[model samples]
Target: MRGHDLINTCLPDELIVEIFHHIESKSTRDACSLVCRRWRRLERLSRSFIRIGATDSPDLFVHLISSRFSNVTTVHIDERISVPLPLSELVKKPDKGASSSSALKLHYMKENNGSTSAEGDFDSLCLSDAGLSALANGYPKLQKLKLIWCSNVTSKGLTSLARKCVSLKALDLQGCYVGDPGMAAVGQCCKNLEDLNLRFCEGVSDKGLVELAVGVGKSLKSLGIAACAKVSNITMEAVGSHCGSLQTLSLDSEFIHNEGVNAVAKGCPNLKALKLQCINLTDDALEAVGVSCLSLELLALYSFQRFTDKGLCAIGNGCKKLKNLTLSDCFFLSDKGLEAIATGCKELTHLEVNGCHNIGTFGLVSVGKFCKHLSELALLYCQKIGDGGLLRVGKGCKFLQALHLVDCSSIGDEAMCAIARGCRNLKKLHIRRCYEIGNKGIIAVGEHCRSLTDLSIRFCDRVGDEALIAIGEGCSLQYLNVSGCHKVGDAGLIAIARGCPQLCYLDVSVLQNLGDMAMTELGEHCPLIREIVISHCRQITDVGLAHLVKSCTMLESCHMVYCSGITSAGVATVVSSCLNIKKVLVEKWKVTPRTKRRAGSVISYLCVDL
Candidate 1:
């Protein structure tokens, strides 16, 4: 007769599971499980992913995984708590005489009493061999596992997991202490593993990597090793000789040199993506890559100054399929090398040139002329680039979609206007500290770029309210950031609020001219606005903040700092008015313990120091 009884009695178990499959929210599924015994069983059967904290009770965790969630296949155990604590609990002060560390120890002891082995100590608060053994026994079907900052776990625990979870395909051991023996066990047992990341695993060395390469052999497809000092050219040789099917490899080490890279290029002909950083490599290594790895599609070289135009030219001539290339801090690279790439790699779609002062108009012009299909371009701190280069690019690359210009002092209004006129399909544009650009350029963008949704102009003192007003009248912007644009005022913001009702994210920080009128307009028109940053807007007062909070009920995040007119009362009003507010970043002086307590468990108050 009742709604609940009708649903329970009418719907079959199979139909209920079909409906459950459509519900993706974990909280909704958890609530459903609490309804009845049948729903709990069904929910557990449908759930496949779970994340647990290392500090959780080992016994209870094993019991829950085995009995409640039998179908789980992906598990993540992190040393950090899965659920963030309430602001009140996070900021709560300890007793007068007791230190915070002592209080934490006492809490840990109370929560984990009798849950650890006799050999356990302070370090035992984190997951250890005992927990891994329990997980192996309970979740034998686990396919993916991520252990983050679980320093207590060693090779012994990994061996236990590998022996049972033979179906594991991906393992991420970021910041773990596992060394050679553990990697050897995983290599020997988990033959199906395809992806492995050992970033920040300081204890691993050449022997471990060699064993892993030998055991996994051709099954391994992706490998990432970074900041492991003990790994050297030996590991590279082993990987090149054994892992013939490898497609993706990223290495960030100071020890690997030309010999190591040459081996990888010679062996792994199917490699499609390669990233190397902080290595003392020469032109010989790059030349080897160009001649051997013809299937390479993506290559990123960073902080390597020894390679010159000759090496890059080889890469361009050989790797015809290369589509994405990024060069950063390569001081020797000039127009000659880039021109070679532009001439050879016509299919290139994305290019980023950063901190390379030698690259200028000639290189960029070559890109505009040859790379007709290019869609994205980013130039950062390239001091030699001027409007001449961009003007050519704007006229040539008609299909360009995204452009990022940062700290390029030589660029001016001519280039921006040219891009606005040419790139009609542009969706995102970011300009930072390009002082020569102003209202004329932005107005052109507003008039021409009808599909533009994301625009960010920071520290460009020349930009004013007219630019924003034009954008508001023309484009349907979803994200707008005018931070550090001193010329932007309330008039511009009001126009934006009235015109772009779909605006969801706005950053008007450091605008001294903006006031309450802009906030009122935003609250009235932009009902969907969810996040706002009004830091350093001294003209804004509590009256405006209250008005904004009262109307914008969907506001989820509000960041207010250094606003001289706003007080504690304004912060309290925001906490109480916006029911959906999850994060409030405010000055430390304005928020008291009482306000934080009132925020309760759902809202997080991040207090910033003055």
Candidate 2:
């Protein structure tokens, strides 16, 4: 009967909503909406997005996500909510004699934001202001909203979600308790807001960011006010006189200096990415970001210890279409600011220099004699970078592909065989605590990179097992961090599970002769292994994590800190065979309350103390 006419026909509802839009996992459209009732009304009209966390009653989980998702368009209020909801019938406030006037000028905005007060965690979760006005009157086509650390969302619940959503377009009140009349009612009602992230919103200041740049700062395009310490410089001169199509800006405070970055570089002339932390900015605000960000391309400067080298040689003689440049703790830049960024940024391609100790090796051979379309390079704790300035950056860039050398310690082995013979189009390599890199510079970077996929050699301790069997007989690796190498054991993790069988993230923490035959040869050659951190591996036991939960199976997070030879029935046989385990950081585990009452909505435990 042709499988009973494909299970009793009656299909067409736009062909069963185009076969449930090819079922794109929301737990498989909630198991095909329990298979039946017309695929549960086309998986409730293809859910538009709903994420309500820590419910055990945050007022009946915001009234069952506003009467079960009435065409939701994005809502995420997660900052810790796994059931525990008893705050003595919370959500009341608003009526300390009808407080307003920007809530009495942010009544000490929770003792100056820096967090620490979830009413002494009587099991947190307090989404007041009438649970965000009953989740903006039950999602009337809500347009993106994320309220993390809600701590009783104030400012009258963000002015009732900027007056009932009004088709809002991205608003993330990070570390919440909104201020400035809930950002002047979300800049006078959404006005089609284009991404606004108020990080650490300590009762927002600068008159609610100059009334949110006089409302929606003319269709604001990405603005992140990091650590809102009463934003200064008159809110960057009213966001440079009304956000002229702003494109990404993150400013950490300390009363932002250099005339508030010369009033956002003479007012956001199509600003394209800028992050300045510990801002009491100098170098005359990076010489006014090379005289007003001429379509700047990614510029990051953290803890500018009074940036010198004449403010990075005036951003390489005026940011010539700069392309990603990050400098942390700019300790009076040296090598004459890399010879003025190899004679003014020649279309740079990502260069990160951390703790610049008066630059070295002629400032990395003047960035391998002029950037040359460089591709990602990070040099941390630049202790006068040696090995002839990384062999002149592997003979001058060569389309370099991601290389990070932490604690440089004058890198060894002829600058790792001159970056395995000039870059070779490398793919992510981080050598931490480079203790004069051994194993012949990790077998010349596993015999010439081989399109290596993320390899981290931490605490090098003379790398072991013939440099991980020359990087498991040559690359194909997917994130493998040999933490504190201590002579990595189990034959360099069975030669990196037989030449990186596409290993997906593995961190051998404190490798003290890792046991269980390298977790049964990384569960028989990494069956899509997803995240593993063997913390303090005292020879990982529990029969090698019960043969790694019967073979990875997309294992999600396992950070066994201080592995005192696993017990509690091997952490209750890894919460009874994986089932897509989500976080299990053990040590002192009484089988974590019987795997949190038999996978209580999917396992989660982080018991420590060895």
Best by lDDT: 1
lDDT of 1 by residue, 1-610 (tens): 4555887788988888888878999889889989998998888888788887643344335444565688789988777765454222432456789766646544544564454565554555567776787788878998999988888789998999999999999999999999999999989999998899999999899998899999997799888989999999999999899999999989899999889989989999999999988558989999999999999999998988899999999999999999999999999999999999999999999999999889998999999999988899999998899998899889989999999999999999999999999999999999999999999999999999999999999999999999999999989999999999999999999999998999999999999999999999998998888999999999999999987887888999988888999999998999998988888877777886778788855444455445
* TM-score of each model, paired residue for residue: 0.91, 0.36
Query: Candidate 2, residues 1-610: lDDT per residue as tens digits?
Result: 6557574376666776677667777888888788887777666776777786765235435654566557778888875755444322342345657546434323422322224556533322466676788788888569999988877779997888688897899988888867798898888988889888888888889998898788888898888888777888898888888888888888888877788778878888788888888646778887887877777888898878876889878878887888888888777788888778766887788888998888888877888778877888899999887888778878988888988989988878788889888988889888899898888877888898889888899998988888888888988888999899888899879888977888889999999988998899889888888889988898889998899779887888888766889777887787688878777776555456766688654434555443
- Residue 605 displacement in candidate 2 (angstroms): 17
- Candidate 2: worst-modelled 10 consecutive residues by lDDT: 105-114
Q: How far is candidate 1 from the true structure (C-alpha RMSD, Å)?
A: 5.5
lDDT of each: 0.87, 0.80
